[model samples]
Target chain A: MSAALKLVDAPRRSVALEVRGVSHAFDLGGKHLPVLDNIDLSVAPGEFVALLGPSGCGKSTLLRLVAGLEQPDVGALLEDGAPITAPDPSRILVFQDPTLFPWRTVWKNVAVGLEARGLLPAHKQRVADALSLVRLEAFAQAYPHQLSGGMAQRAALARALVNDPHLLLLDEPLGKLDSLTRLAMQNELVSLWQKVGFTALLVTHDVEEALLLADRVIVLSDRPARIVTEFLIDKPRPRRRDDADLVHLRQTILATLGPVHD
Target chain B: MSDIAQGGAVRTVASVPIWRDGVAAAAAWFVAAIVTVATPDVVPWGSTPLWAEILTGGAVLLLVLSGTVQWLGRVGRVVVHYGPWLVALGVWFAVWEVVTAKTGWLPKPFFSPPQGLLHVYLVDTTRLGLCVLFSLRLWAYGFGSGVIAGFLVGVALGWSKRFAYWGMPILKLIGPVPATAWIPCTFFILPTTFSASVFLVALASGIPVAILTASGVGSVNRAFYDVARTLGASERFLVWRVAVPASLPHVFVGLFMGLYYSFAVLVVAEMLGAKYGLGWYLQFQTGYSAYANVYATLVIMALLTSGLVKLLFVTRDRVLSWQKGII
Candidate 1:
């Protein structure tokens, strides 16, 4: 028990995530701005869930709560039946921005999780492996600025994947890419998730994207976000973008995200 | 914008052989020779005929130096680039020598010929070398400690709100005041004049670094911290690894400010107390109306400061090489 905290490992450990009645608010100077209200979500192990919502609907806030970067004002987030009170290497978040440390090379950025945990010396090969996984072994020595937008995001993905995270919280990780790059990355992400089998909670506003990639899509209400509606995607792997089933589901999800009607 | 365009034109011209160095350097040598050999000293205010011979020798040396440009190393390349400036310098020197030593247009005791300054170097090399050594020691001790401590404090203030709450107001208050303003109190607090001088220099250089470092650390994109935190960074790792590296550019800016301030304070401190430094030499020479010595010391100071600044620039370029399109 005493030596448990200091033990070393970088092996994959996929786990379930549960968010129970989580509510959160921020104090901007003196004003109280509510962001999330009574959010209840449960993700099964190895599930890929896409969260779709209206703009400014606290999608990022909910992701932050799950990543353990912030504590909810009320309720709790659990991973594998254990409450998450603080950030751990087991659960990593990839932000909308690549957020690659500008001073470090792509390889070093990928090594950050292991370096932070003092496991870098033993697991150096993992950094190279992660870069190879993103097909960026050619760019290991390159800085973030030296890379294009698509490459930079790929490096960010490598940085997250290097940790062998149990849960990957993606906050619109592909939001800033051009259309062609976004399409390519969407496919790459689906394939990587399939291989790694980590439970994924992706936050995105693209309705078709959610339908194409996610096993389930959950929509949220506008600011002070609450779970509004959800859809179960039962299609087989490698679903086509122009497929009739996806087209119909995208329309439904878009309507749910569109303006409210009395 | 026009200046950059002009630089582009000049760069293209630089590819030519004669335009790069030969024509301009030859012109400089010709002008310098004409002024030195043809003219006679007027109303000799204790002027040396030997200086004219030396100027003639310099003209011949320039011709030889220009011819060997292709064979000379890095310094040779620099001479080629600044060939026009060298010609202008020759013209300026001719005007100076004629006005000061030959015609005596500028009055005595206030101005000097270039050779007059050179004479100080030739005669007083030992004393000047000692002063140089002392000044270097003082600067090394003061600026080195100041930068290291200030950087750590700046990181702390930027990283933790509680640290900032206690430190920021005090830093802001102390930052604006000149380092020399504390001279009276510094003398009483420190045991020796040397330590007192070091404190002043340290204070001068440390403040800018601290302020700039704080701002740099504090202004880092919060997303970086979020990512690092989720990767299981401890507080120590966040500070030393994340905050320090992110804030380095700002810290360097501070280091530059401190370097200048410490030098300014260093000179003033030497003027005040028991010291063998360039500042003391300047003060001592000025007291005796040795304008030549003062000018020589000023030249040394300029060269030293510029060299140090270049070194700092090289280090910054290496460390922040990841930053894009800065130059």
Candidate 2:
């Protein structure tokens, strides 16, 4: 698959987002409980990285820290050598649910981040281009209620893309989708990433999804989660579902997570 | 020529009615008239004439026939949907007229014969219209300000837990007190009677809006806020754009409830001090023993309340159309 895409020879840029020695916890009724402990990660510009772990492994916490939605108690997150203090338009997050505003049409939802940034005049064409890229041009004027689950997620994706974010954080964005739509969106996401060349950090419990999408997969341990292992996919864009090497990697990650004995 | 074509034509043709609905209506009217005429009242009937009885019976018949025609699809869809209700209303009017005219349980002229009340409705249109306008103006002013303030303060309290913790208790302490309870204080604090009424109405309505909006904001999915944060929405944007919209459905519920309270409070406030509102007219008519006018005012109040609610429903449908099939 890598040979077919021939992306390996393409010039790779420096890291667009970096996290070092980050830790986070919550004060639950006066008792502090740690969630993520001593995390370190880096994403080169145009790279696709996946954080795969069990339900309580705090992969989402790591993504939030990098997105500036939450602050790490111990360490720093940097974008282009500058520390990130708050959320910026250069980092966009997509969630498991579409989370499109119920009052807005698809076009308005896609344009919301730009509108929020007061960049409508400067980014109007970019918004339309992003929607077309997601193949949702026909649904631009349709409200969220009029869209199917798959279409709504695509709109959410378009909304994230329109800003041309330097870092894209996906927190189990496909977890709620049906198996077929999940597979289809996984392909769409990979192609979009390749074309747009934005760095991506996806968090998912599905080992296969991680292997199929990410250039690098980071596995995390249980509560007070820390990085347990990292595996490089070495596969290419438009990678096959049944690729022998990808299947092997999925099985390996599954075994590392837990036993399948019955 | 073909069996399928013949069957379709037959189905279409079979849909028409064989008899005119007016025949059935006339039969029902004839029976009612005969029964009323035959059953002579031992006591003197109050203010009801033979002509009025006949007219009321005919009106009932007309309503029933209209409903039947609608149900049979001789008319359009809206008529068919509202047909039974129209028929029920006609019957209700007929029964009320009969009971008031023939029965001794009600005082004379207090429950004015339906004809007299109807006459008041026709003749007093100007007075009724003015009262409706007065009430609606108060409603718009109070309800609008209440909803806006509720949403803003609610979002503020909802976003910060510390604010919610301190503010919620204060709100709870004050919110349970009815809006009408402040009427006495309003009279003293406010100089003008109309202004006082509006103040009472707004205060009464605003409390519920504030409480409901806060709770609505509190109930927003935390994950959604996280999404907004990641998208780089500023605190102001998060509250106005994300939190407010997300909590709108619940906020609407509060607005509706507030509208109801506003109407009730407005009437009370007006009756206590104002000189020109519907409540004032109601009190004046009752004092003068103008039974017909009193009933007319009561009818007007019912119409205004229901009409305001219907307007809200239409606005809600338009604004929240995106939530179709969701809630």
Candidate 3:
């Protein structure tokens, strides 16, 4: 908690990101499977946007491109008008799986980025605060196997958050949680976003989640995904689950998902 | 109803300390002591039948130990719990004595009584001690160098695609052949008999370790690497921290196999050329028809192997305790 407070007291350091004419495909053996069309998007500093898409759509591919893990076949990803040629600690991505190093305790997993960058000695307290932010300070010494699904996701979130990242790329982070935990995590995520104020681009299949937390939800079409539509939510904080407007928007979005392929 | 209640009260007498566990163990040893003293040797007593004295002495010791079992702490308590096995051991000794020495059902020239083996240990202590020290030194150097080289090569094979492509084919080709097959070439290739013996032991131990370690490293989930990479881990960190740690269970499996193979190779290699090892002592005793000394050396070798195996198990449990609940 002290580290987060100290970080807040320091000057803001979040950077803006821009994705221009980005298109991507993956090589499956000798075959090329096109996943992302030439899509353009931009995220402002401190903005929270959700990329909502169908299951096999190219939402995750787009996130990876912006993360610099994969380069787009065409066009480029720029952060603050500079090209992202490699993965940097300034931008971090949290995958659907917690992906916690099983041999490490929760504290060590959160400290991994700091240790890798050779900054552990100067910023040890930040690991504690990151765990505290996830309400898992009590479990800092515990292994990932000891934690429940929701707790593991929280630890993953803390791992990204500890970098004090300018841009946080979330790839369906809460997808594996039970429905009750999912609802609770949705609220926790919104509150954490409000507190830290990092620019978040969440890729999720949950329509209601986007409506509840995201400032703007960009829905993509099927495979070779193109941006089909976007909805801007201007709701007040503490939005209720049973809010009429949210239910109406959810119905409209579900209809847009189309009929099941099966 | 009152009569039944009185019957239940009478059943509590079964808890009497007179009928406790140590009683049976003590009784069995007493019977063994009496048998040892009374039995007449069918063959002329070699070296004064020292076993009867040892048996009497052992019975006395067990009685004292069992009496003070409470003072033995946790280990003593466990020993007392296994009192029945001790009782069985006493009975087995008596039966073996009656069959071999007393009745001569199994005669000498091939089999010797327990006293004959004990007499060898009592008279040849210094020479046997030297042989043990020499064997241990050779084993330590051979197994140590073997495992270290194998582990490094395994890591390279598992981590690098190019290395695996070239090295794996050779490893697979040479792996199935037994270490003893290399003895002829090793004797000519190395300068000394000891060096040749060491090479044999190293080859026997190193192959399994290298093969298993490569497979273990190769089978690690690719997702772990991706996770570490995104966490800003350098290439070196990914190989050492992620790949190596994740593949440890397999490495341990390799180590165990390698340990057994090395022990087998050690005995064979010592027999072929070494001058001062337990294997050499066994061969020398056999040539002199001193079967007693051969049996004594075999017992020593068995104990050494088991002790080393127990130590390895302890180390594994400590390092891999993270797999406790899951495994």
Candidate 4:
């Protein structure tokens, strides 16, 4: 608790992200299949933004480009004023599957970032702090296979947080979770964002998830994803699902997403 | 009153040692000693008195154990579990003695009585010991070098596309051919018979490990690489820390195959132009019609091979402990 309190006082060094005229496509067999088309977006430092889209709208592709894992066919991604060319410890992406290294204990998995950067010797305490942040200290010695679904995902979050990443790219990080765990984790994510104050970009198919967590929610069209609309969620913290304004926003976003096609 | 009576009966039963199997084993051994001492052999075999004395000793030991085994705890359980086998072994020995030595039904210079085997052990201890040492040294050198070279080749083939392209076809071509087939060429090509024998063993052991390890490394999930990369892992870290550890289960499979293959090739390799090995001893004894020595050596080979296989199993269980529930 003291460490978490100390983190609030530590100056936040979050960077503004800019995606300008970004377009990407995949070569499936002999044909070119476009995924993202001419996307222009800017995120303020320390802001919480969520991208809401259909199942295959290429929202995840945008996150990968920002992470510098893959380059866009056109245009550039900038971190502050500098171009993002390759993956750096300052930016971390968490996937829906948790993807914890199966061989390592939960503590070792969370310590991976620090170990990779050769900072583990100096910043060992950060691993404990990160585990405590996600309330996984008791399970630090457990393997990924031994953990429950929610605990595994929390361990994944702790793995990302150990690096003190300036930008967290969440590609449907909570998509695979059950509804009850999803609700609890959404609140935990809000608390984590408010406490640590890093710029977060989440991609989710659920409109309510976007409305509940994000400061700004961007919706994208299907296939070759283009920005359809953006909603500013100016609700206060601890927003209720039944809040009249959030309900109205959910209904509007759902209508725009078109009839539920399940 | 009835409950108290039942509890007293249970207590009395618990206090009494269970001695059924032990008594049976003791009787069998006693019979074996009686047969060895009372019946005259169709032909003379030395160590007959010593063998009878050994059987009587085993009978005495079993009779003593039946009265005391309950106090031995864990060891007592193991003794009880193997009690039936002990009885069967003693009966088997009595029958074997009657057929081979007492009746001469199995004939001489072909099948030896247990006493004949014991006589060979007493007379040829020095030569047998030397053969065991020589066989172990050749096995160690061939198996060690084969596994190391195979592991390196497997890693290279799995990791690099260019290496796989050049190496895969060659490996596939030679992998199915028996290593003994190369003896005809290796004997002429290599300067020494020792070198040729070592080459044959190495080839037999190395191929399976290479094939299995390469497949193991190749089949590792690609998502693991992606996860490691996003965590700021270097290429070296990805290979050593991630790829290598992930592929270990497959490598172990390869190791087990290699171990068995090496044993097979070692015996065959030793049979061809080998100076001092168990296989050579077998050939030399067969030439002299020393079937008793051959039987003794075969028993030694069985114990050695099975003991090595058990050692491999223990090592696998220790190294792959993390894979317990997952597998």
lDDT of 2 by residue, B21-60 (tens): 3444444444444444554433444323553566556756
lDDT of 4 by residue, A1-262 (tens): 3443244455778899999999999999989999999999999999999999999889999998998889999999999989999888789999989998888899999999889878788777888888999999999999899999999999999999888888999999999999999999999999999998999999999899999999999989997999989999998998899999999999899888887422
Query: Could you give the CAPRI-style class of model 3?
Result: medium
Regions of model 1 farther than 4 Å from truth: A1-12, A260-262, B1-27, B30-54, B71-76
Comparing 2 and 3 on DockQ, the stronger one: 3
Q: Per-residue CA lDDT of candidate 3, range B1-327, in tens?
A: 454587765343433233235656666766766676686778864653467766666677777775677777898879888888888988887787777777888787566767767778889999999999989988898888888888888989999999999999999999999999999999989999999988888888888889988998999988677666777889888888888888889988988999999998898888889899998898888999888799889999999999999999999998887676657
Best by TM-score: 4
Give the count of colliding residue pairs in each prediction.
1, 0, 0, 0
> What's the TM-score of chain A alone for every prediction?
0.94, 0.91, 0.95, 0.96
The candidate 3 chain A region of ten consecutive residues with least summed lDDT is: A1-10
By lDDT, highest first, what's the ranking? Answer: 4, 1, 3, 2
Give the 10-residue window scoring lowest on summed lDDT in candidate 2 chain A.
A1-10
Off by over 4 Å in 2: A1-15, A258-262, B1-75, B80-95, B102-107, B122-126, B160-166
| Every candidate's lDDT | 0.85, 0.77, 0.84, 0.90
The DockQ-based CAPRI class assigned to model 4 is: medium
TM-score of chain B of each: 0.87, 0.79, 0.90, 0.93
Order by TM-score, highest first: 4, 3, 1, 2
Would you list the clashing residue pairs of candidate 1?
A: B205-B258
lDDT of 4 by residue, B1-327 (tens): 454687754343344665789989999999999999899988898999999999999999999888888889999889989999999999999999999999999989898989998998888899999999999988888888898889889888888899999999999999999998898899999999888888888888889889888988898888788777888999888888888888889999999999998988888888888999998999899999989999999999999999999998999998877687897
Q: Model 4, which residues run further than 4 Å from truth?
A: A1-10, A260-262, B1-15
Q: Order of all candidates by DockQ, from best down to worst?
A: 1, 4, 3, 2
lDDT (Cα, tens digit) per residue for candidate 1, span B195-277:
99988888888889889999999998888888899998998888889988998888989988898898899999998984699
Per-prediction DockQ, in order?
A: 0.75, 0.59, 0.60, 0.68
